[model samples]
Each structure stands twice: as C-alpha cells, then as structure tokens.
Target: MTLRRLHSLQQWLKEKDVAYAFIQGKANLFYLTGFRCEPHERLVSLLVFQDNEPCLIAPNMETSLICQSGWNYPIIGYSDSEDPWRLISTHLSSLEIVGSNLAVEKELLSVARAEQIKALSPELALLNCEDTIMKLRLIKNDKEIAILKEAAKLADFGVEVGVHALNTGRTEMEILAMIEYELKRKGIREMSFGTLVLSGEQSANPHGKPKMKSIEKGELVLFDLGVVLEGYCSDITRTVAFGNISTEQEKIYETVLTAQEATLSLCRKGTVLGDLDRKARSIITDAGYGAYFPHRIGHGLGVEVHELPSLNENNQDQLQVGMTFTIEPGIYVPKVGGVRIEDDVLITEDGYECLTHYPKELLVVKP
Candidate 1:
C-alpha cells in the first residue's frame, strides 16, 4: 500500500525539520496512499507527520473504498455539511502540528485552500515540498513499470481500434466515438487525455480540435490517444495514410518516423535529457521542417500522462534506468497535413525498451 513511500516522506520531513506534509494532488495522493479518488469541490488529502502515523482526510462516502484499497491508517471522514479544514486544524493541534513548519504541494494546492490552512496556523512556516515529492516519484518502481507496460498494450490497442474505425468521408468525431466505445467495451475507464482524431488538412493544426469535418481520401489521419489502465497511463500517436497518398505526404511521414526512431535509439541510461530532444529536433530541422515541428520531443508518463522531466531542448536532467517517458516527433504544415509518431519508452540499464509496440510504418487504409 505504498507504506514504504510514506516512510520515505517521513524521513524527508525529519531531515528537513518540517512538522508535516499536506498532499493535495490527486495523482500524488494516490501514489503515496494507494487510494484514488476525485473529490472535486470537496477536500481530499493525506496528512503525513514526521513522527506519527499518517492521517487521511476524505469524504465520508469514500471511506469504504479507501479501506478496500489497502489503506488502514487513521481516517477522519467529514460530511459535506461539516468543515474539513477546521477538522484538519483540530487534528493538527492534537498531534502537536500547530505553530510548526509545514510542507505542501505548491502546484496542486489551490489559493483558497492555502488561505484556509493559513487561517488555522498563521505562525506556521509553509514550505513547498513539490520537488521533494516529484523526486520520489521520478524513478518508477518495478511494480509501476509493470503496470505501465500493460497500459502500453492497451494504448496500442486503442490505436488499432482508431485505425480500423477510419474510413473515407467519416467525420473526426465519429471515429473518435468509435474508438472510445471500443475501449469502454474492453473495460478502460478513462483515456489519459482527450482522444485526438484529426484528418485531412485539419490534422495539420497539431493540437486541433476534432470537428465534424469528413476525412477525405489521400489525406493524413493523425490518431493521438492513450488509455489509463490499472492506475498507470500510456500515450501514443500514429499518423496514417487514408486511401491514396502523395510523395510529399509520404516524405513528411517518413521524416517524422526517422526523428522518432533516432531519438528512441538514444533512450538509455546516463543520457542527458536535453540530448534526446536535440537528436529529434536536429533530424526534423535537417529535413527542412524545423518550423513545422514546434513542440518539445515528449514528456514523462506515469499516473499522469505529463509529469516530471519534460524532454525539451533546455532540460538538463539525465535519463536513468527505471525512468519512463515518451519520444514523439512531428511535422505539421498549415495547408498540408501533419505526421506524428510517439511511443512510450523505458530507460534500461544498457539500452531501452519500447513499451508501446504499435506499428510506426506508413499504413494506407482501404477507403
């Protein structure tokens, strides 16, 4: 139940002289506590003290699920009519957490909630522990890597569903619906991100929204999607030819494929993170599509699709074994179509393993 992670946090608190740590991010909360829930407007958190048992503050309705998830710690559930922050203050006082140093997730905690915590302990020194938590979560454990591998298979399955659903004159939304429906039938509760199905010229927009526009013949169809399976996530993007295609279209697709492959080949232990982005960017730039390929190479993937160690040209982090991320390179033209090939990868001791095994070769579907 991630009790080891809890101990690690407590050790960090003791070293830093922090009294307590307030974990508010849903992803971080699930990572440390083994409990997953989205309270929305309601308050859901895990309070960890330096020298005491951790406490879980959650909605009364979620108590059973929290226990079922293997969390056997002290839980203080509050009804919607009750004040959660006030209860937290009382708990803090009882544990001698009042008027002491406190650490919190600066990125995840909202302004109003921070204000409420301050009201409870105005003299309390508030510190940001986001980086410390991120450092703990950066390198995936063996179990997390295994779950990510399964998730990668589901992500590849998602691409297969989307590709099979592709047809001439089919609207982008229709294909999106077909893909999502197929995933739901397979028991995938959610996608890592919104399903992206862009066809023809619409695909050139890179981040374009799926519309009712029909996918015409000889157009490029980009499928950027992933599925959340067993709490981990997998993201993949594959651009394919619809019916007949032109030489220019095929060249763009090939260039992007080359960039992805070259960047992936460099995903091993001790590799500087920025070099990966540079390798892909250099290939795209040498292909005369530098301006078209605008976005960073990729991002770290795990409980959240985007996480630590963003693969950008300026990042200085080094890739280590057990760290997982994506390597995606694309070329998007205005009037023309776009081509993006992405794969989830795991940095290994010697080389690397491609988690998402979906075919990146140009596939021309029958219309």
Candidate 2:
C-alpha cells in the first residue's frame, strides 16, 4: 500500500527533473516510510534516486522493524561510525553518470546540513522538492479523508467535554488539563500542535496559552484545539461568552460569524484560493472592522498541521475537487477580545462540503 504511493511520488519527482531527493524531516520520512519514531533518537532518512523507487537510511536497530513491514524498498542500515550525511555522496555516485538533479526538503534541512549537501554534491544541481511533495498531498484520496473525518469526530468529542467542563470556578489551566486527560483516556493521539484555552482579555492574543485565572462571567472564552486519529489531524476553534450583556461584544461575535458563514457558502471547485479569502475578508472589512481582521483567512490542514494550497491572499493555486482544507476568519482587537470561527471543508465537483459539522453558529455556554 505504501510502496504504490511512494513509487508514484518518485515518478512525479522525475517528471519535475528531480533526480536525487532526500527526506530527513520526520513528517516526510513517515510519508515515504510507513514507520515513525521519536524525533531525537532515530534521525532516520531516505535517499530516493531518479530511476530507483526509494531507499531508507536508518540506524541498525530499526532494520528489523523496517524489514518486518515488508516494504518494497531496500532498507540500508548505517552505523554511528559512518555519517548519515556523507551517505548521500555514496548514493549519488550512481547519479554522477546520469548527471542528475538533487533536491531536499527546504523547510526541514538545517543550514549546516544544507551547506554540507551543497559542498558534497558540487557537481549536481539542487532544487526544492518540498513543493513536489506538498502538491501530491493537497488532494486527499478516500482513505485519507476517512482518516481526517474520524479525527474531526474525535476533536468534536473533546470540544463537547471541554464545554461541559467550563464551570464558573474552573481555571483556564484546569480546563486545558481536562481536555488533555479526556483525549488521553479515549486513546486519542497527542495534539499535532499545542492546545489553547484562553479566557477574558487573554482572548485578544491569537495563540494564547492556558493561564491560572479562574473562569468568570461576562467574558469570552476561546478554545482552539485539535486531536490526532490514526496519524491524521483535525483542527477546530470555537469562541463562547461565559456571561455577557455588552452590545459591542455581541456585535463582534456576530460579525465574525457572518464572515465565516459567507466564506463557507462561497467555497466550491474552480474557485481561486485568493478569491475565497476575499469573500470572508470583504464581509468583515465592510462591517467597519477591516484592520481587526488580520492574518490569512485560513491554511491547508493535513498530515502535518499546515500544508499547501493555503487559503491566503498570495496563493496562486486553484481550488480543485477532492482537496481538504479549513475556512477560519477571525476579528481580533488587542486587549479587548477576539472571535474565530473555523471549519474544515472538503471540495467536491458539485461544490464544497463541511466535514466539521459541530455547530457553525457561536455556542454560548453560561458560566
């Protein structure tokens, strides 16, 4: 199952004129090799040549696991004495005859490692392979969407538990703790990213972490979180007012909600990504809060929390059917508070479908 996908990837790389490609980042390694290990100990990598399908370079201890998986590629084990980076030169000697193009993950490779590769392969031309991998991953197949759907359900379950746990006396830190505990109890994987539980004035900060302050009335609480299921990820953010009477707070909430709903309604196949972002931004800007709506509308959500085909102003990609992503529009006012309504959408030939069905309207839970 994994080999077929990898072989297709290598073929695409060849078509892109990428002859010698390296995969060092754990995310890319896991994509190529179905096996995953901690980030520090293993330091596993794969070197895929032009004609060859793919080959993994890893520590000797992990050979048994790789072999047991019955993968299609050869598992070449390296020792501590033989440097992994230098192993590139050993593999590229074949490419020398072919005079191949070498590429690596731009975001993952460190400056030092990149310098080494540049020096070692002075003969071969180097290019960015990250885009190649990202484009392939943008459109999910049936199996991939099924995994994400399950993950979304788990995230919804966690959010339900969090809403019930948001008592008047509980602290933001306490609710964050409960979320972690519930996810762990259900055998859910750790967060692909950090969990956020911000309350009151703290909600003004987009990525605020949980604090020790107790939950209070007349304040908005923002819970930005997700859960991983079967190695796939789900992300959702909901804002609720514990207790409120101010017209301004309600206005802000309603305006942001309207903007998000407008975007969701406009999503469909053949829509330009930048145009999609404009739909949401235009609504919020017309409400006389243009400056408050900062940041891109949303981003692609996938195996790694962020992926390609971003729903931003600079995206040149067109929205194709079978692509899965998020539509989150927010209004932030420093020191006052903020509201963000996000939902994951899957593109279809007919239009776009919202995978995240947990209430688009704001859920106001009393404190």
Candidate 3:
C-alpha cells in the first residue's frame, strides 16, 4: 500500500498547514497506489489528506479494477460526460478543505487543470509540493532495489542483443528493430527511454535518432538503451567499434571509460552529489574534450527513468544509502564519433554497488 510514503507525505502536509495534496503525476500516483493507468483526456488522480483517508478519483471504466487492486480506501469514479472537479469538490468540502491551502504538483500539473481546481474552491490557496514529493521518493526501499537490479540485468541483455545484431552494412534502424524484437520475445514490455543506435559520424549527436544509413567497418557505434521490467527501469550506454578502429577513436573511448570509472569510484554515501559530475568533467577536460561532454554525469533512476537528485554541478545534495542513479560520461566530437559508458549504481552503507554489469571495455563487432 506504500503506507510509509503516505505517512511521510501527510506529515509534510501537516507541516505546511495544507489540508490535502493532489498527486497528479501518473508515476507518483502509481508509487503511492498499486494501480497505474493513463487516462488521456480524463481526470485520474489521488487526493491525499493530512488527517483523513486518501481518495482515488478515476474514470468509471477503472472503478472495478481499482476495487480489486486491494485499495481499501474511497474510490470516486466519474463518467465521461461529468465534471470530475465537482465530485472532488464534494469530497474536499466534506473534509473541510475549502478556503484552505492545498498542495499540488506544480511541475506536472497543467495550467488549465490548476485553474479548474481553483474554480472548485474560490478561496483555496494552491502550494507547490514537488520538492516535498521528491524528498519522499529519493530513497529506494529493499523491494525497489531488488526490482531495479532485475531491470539492470535486462538492460545488459539488451546491449548484448544489439552487439550481436550489428553488421558492416546493417542500418541503425535495422539494428534497433532487431534489439527491440528480441527483447520483446524475452518479455520486455517497454524501453525506459527511446532506443538510440548511432553509427560513425552520427554518434557525435548525443541524442540523435537512428537513421537508415548503413554502418561501415572501422567506425564507432553507440548503443544507448534501457528497459522497463516489473515497474522499475534501467538505462545504459555503450560505444563499441565495428572492425579496426583508429588511435584517435581508441583515445576518446578510453578517456570516457576512465572518466566514468573514476566518477563511479566516488559514489559512496555522504559524498556530495555534484562532486561526481565535477570529477568526471575534470577528467574529460584534462583530455581536451570538456566542451564535447555537454550533459550532466547522470540522473536518479527508479519508477520513472529520471527522478530526483540529478548528478550535475550546482546541486549540493549528498549521496545517501539506498539512493540509485546512473553514471554516464561521454565524449562527443563533431565529424568523428562519440563514446559514452554508463552504468546503474546503488549507494550502500559502506560504498556503492554497480547494478549494470555489462562489460565496459571496448567491444569490437566483426564485419
């Protein structure tokens, strides 16, 4: 039931003098409630109160499923032609929430939705609760860690599939298709993020989409992919060579590898989160590829691929036990190619554990 999470949230609401909270983010809703779904144009939400039973407001179509999901709370369902806010207003008034401060996820709630909620109660003061929710979701429980470990294994298998499907003349799209097809055959329902397969000069674009261009020998191929397994997510990136590679390519690959490994070594509890990015940046800058490494070192990974505690400069948060995130450092050179080595890691009491055990050493696919 995620009761611990609810307790923490209720405590936060009490501290802020908020009557209740509207958790609108789909991912956050699933984290607190066991059920998950997307209601496109319909209103699906979880209204949590500081001192009362939480309510799950969903479409009428999902009412039976919500009841069967073992949610022993109030389930408020509305028809397509009805106004959800009206029912919500009834519930809020019953709880004496009118003219009180209510917390909402400002980062996710749309402006139109906020206006609707304001219309529901003219005197309601809406406060942003994204920071409070981020704190609640920062630490991973034992079950979450276990699910993430399994997801990481699937991610490694995905890389292996992509590496085996590589050929001298295969298009990037072809390889991407083969990788996804094989993973689906093994029960991977979805990828955490878009599957990126870039070859040769195309790899220079860190977030480039796969193209139909044929892969050639003696060039670098970057595979950045992840998978969703058991509601958890895994993300990884590995750059490999086709046939024979040049010394410059080897240098770039090695430099990124060194930077990634060095930063990973400092991923222990109590270490400043931003220092990891600075440490990796130092290595890349020393190798004269600082500008090429554009993005941050990595981000937190869990129910959603990207979560709290981003590993980048300017964030002063310290790593804590049970926190999981990625460590990806890349070197992208225009007209040449890019090299990115990423691994999911978990912070422990003593040190950090690397979850994704895919080989980071340069892999060469034969023609």
Candidate 4:
C-alpha cells in the first residue's frame, strides 16, 4: 500500500518536472512515508528527485528508528551538530543538475527554513509546491477511508461516555476529563484535538474552553470532540439540553438541527457543494435566526480536523465519492446560550453515509 502511494507521488513529481522536492510537514511526511513521530525537535524530510527513488533524511539518532518503521525506503541520517543542508546540497550537486527545478511546500515550510534551503542550493529554482500537495491530498483512497471510519467510530463512543457523565453538579472540566479518559479506554492512542465541552452560559461563546463552573439548570450542554485512530482523525459535536429547555433555546436547537439535516441531505455524488451550505443558511434565515449562524455550514474532515472542499458561499466543487467532511450548523446568541449539531459524513457513489451515531435529541439531564 505504501509503495503504491510512493509511485503515485513519483508520478506527480515527474509530471511537474520537479528534479527535487522537499517534503517536511508532518502530514506530508506521514502521507508519503508512514513515519509518525512523537513531538520533538527533529527535522524530518523526504527529498524526492526526478528518478523516483528518493532519500529520507533525518537526524542521526532517529535514523534507525525511522528506517525500520515499515517505510521500506533508503534513509540517510545526519548528526544534529552537522549541517544537514550541506549533505543535502552535496547530494543535489552530485545527483541532479545545479539549475534543476526544486519545489518546496510554501504553506508548510517556515520562511527561515526555506531561506536555509535556498542557501544550500543557490542555483536551484525554488517554487511553492503547495498546489501539488493539496491536489494529492484532496481525494482519499481505500486505505485512508478505512482509517477515517475507525476514527469516527471511536470518537462517537467517547462522546457517548461523556454524555452519560453530564449532570447539574458536574464541573465542565470534570466532564472534559471523563471524555479524555473514555477516549483512552476505547483504545484511542490520543485525542485528535482537546475536547470542547461547554455548559450553560459558556456555550454562548462560540469557542469557549471548558471551565470549573458547574453546569447549571436549563442550559445547553455541548460536546465537541474527536479521536485519532490508526493515524486518521474524526470530529463530531452533539448538543443536549440539561434540565428544562426554554422556548428560545428549543427553537435554536431545532433550527440548527434542521439546517444540519438539510445540509447532509444534499450530500451525494454530483451534488453542488455550495448549495448544501446555502440550504443550511436558508433554514436559519427562514427561522429568523440567520445572523446567528456565523460560520460556514461545514468543512472537509480527514487527516486534519479541517481539510478541503469547504461548504461555504463561494465553493463550486461537486461532492465526490470517498470524500468525508463535517456538517455542523450552529446558532450562537450571546448571553442567551448556543446550540449546534454536527456529524461526520462520507460521500458515496449513490448518496452519503452518516458516520456519527451519537443521539441528537434534546435530552434534559436533570440537576
């Protein structure tokens, strides 16, 4: 499977007339080579040349660890104390022509790093390869799809556990802690992003953090979370009312829920992407709460929490099979609290398949 990916990458390299392309971003590194690194100060890059056979470069200490990581590629290591760019330049000078075109990921490469690489090979043509990589990652193959499904399932399970733990007296932090623990218990190696758990008035702030304040009566409880499973990620959000929900709160919840459902209903092969977003917005507007729905209807979800083919006003891309993204419609009224319903969905050949199964009904958790 990895080799197939490598071949595809090499083909892209050849088509672009790229003599040497440096890949340094974690997502790019993981996509090209399955070497997931623990957070540390280290340089991980793949220098692929016109010949298709590329060299994996990293600090000396991690060389063997990476080489044995099932990547099945020749890796070259350099000591941290030594100038790795010198080694890179030497290889470039010996292997490829001095004036050969080289592409660097502008979005991923730090300006300082790009300058450093330029200093290594002053004669090489450097251009941003962001478009190339973006195109490559736009579509997911079978392997990625399976991993994504696992991620979605585990995240849904975590939310379920978190929901059961919510009550009037439970601190927002306590609920978040339980969600984190549940993710670990479910065999999730790590949380994709820190869980977003908001209770009551805190929910009024769109991106508020979990707090020590206790969840109060008659307020919305929002659980927004995802987990990393098999190198992929999942994202989901479920809002349930605790105690008696007021008329305004119920209307907000019902409106957002309707918009979310309408957005998903438009997800099928050949569907106009932007139309779904408009549908969500239309629902909110018709409900007399359009101005409150500030964010886009949805965004693609995969390796990263936010990917591509964003469901917004301007996007014109057609929904395609194998594409997975989020449909989260929200209505946030400051001081009045908020309501949002989100789900991970997969676009199939015929229609769409909903990956998230967490209950969406307004469950009034008693104080």
- Which candidate leads the pack in TM-score? 1
Task: Please list the residue runs of candidate 4 whose C-alpha ends up more than 4 Å from where it truly belongs after superposition.
Answer: 97-99
Clashing pairs in 2: none
**Candidate 3 clash pair list:** none
- Per-residue CA lDDT of candidate 2, range 238-323, in tens? 88888763677788899999988888777888788998789888988999888988888888877777776788987877898888
lDDT of 3 by residue, 1-367 (tens): 4788888888888888887888878778878877767779888899888889999999999989877766778999999888889899887777755226878898787889988876866666899988888877889989999999999998899899889988878999999999899889999888998999999999999999999989999889999999987678899999999998999899999999999989989999989999999999999999999999999999999988999889989889899999999999999999889999999999999899999998989988889
Per-candidate Cα lDDT values, in order, are 0.89, 0.78, 0.89, 0.80
Tens-place lDDT per residue, model 4, 327-348, is 9999998878888888888988
- CA displacement after TM-score superposition, residue 320 of candidate 2 (Å): 0.7
Off by over 4 Å in 2: 64-70, 79-82, 86-97
Where does model 3 exceed 4 Å of error? none
lDDT of 1 at 14: 87
Better-scoring candidate (lDDT), 2 or 4: 4
| Model 1, C-alpha of 10: deviation from truth (Å) | 0.8
Q: What is the TM-score (0 to 1) of candidate 4? A: 0.95
